[model samples]
Target: MSITPDKAQRIAALAKLAISPDQAIRLAAQMDDILGYMDTLNSLDTSGVEPMYTPVEHVSVLRPDVMRQDISRADLLRNAPETNGESFVVPRII
Candidate 1:
């Protein structure tokens, strides 16, 4: 399919693009070249080729979930700007 100036103008308008008349003519020719290349690619036959989903093989490494150390609440609350008896306090948002 070939792209004409009128078609290019309509495409630019639909895409909310502000292009000059000269730019529209150039864009039409560029679009035609792109469609021509796509047509050439469509002519290639790949009947037995396997489709690749990812470029490389991937494996998930699993690890056991276990706690190694314990932290005191006093140590955590020491850096807070304001804190209640057991938790940090902050300004309330509605």
Candidate 2:
């Protein structure tokens, strides 16, 4: 798999990237090398191998969900510039 500077420029444009002519040539060669490596990896036989759900096997440490009233709602809403008895007031939009 060989990549040309023209192909590199097209790839850069599609990715919304700005690259110089020299940079395009360099990137094209790098892309060709990567594709060649991918082709090598694809040739490996792994029909019996099971797919991984995650890289590492570990149980998640979760915290218990408990409701705690740290402060009153009236105290929190007191700082608002314009707030109704129940909630903060905002401009109506259609």
- Candidate whose lDDT is highest: 2
Residue 77 error, candidate 2, Å: 24
CA-RMSD of model 2: 9.2
lDDT of 2 at 80: 94
Instruction: Please list the C-alpha lDDT of all candidates, in the order they appear.
Output: 0.87, 0.90
- Best prediction by TM-score: 2
> Residue by residue across 9-92, what tens digits does model 1's lDDT show?
999899999788899899999999988888986778989989897876768666889776587899888899999958999899
Prediction-by-prediction clash tally: 0, 0
RMSD of 1: 11.6
lDDT of 2 by residue, 1-94 (tens): 5889999999899999999999999999999999988898688898999989787677877788988999899998999999987799999977
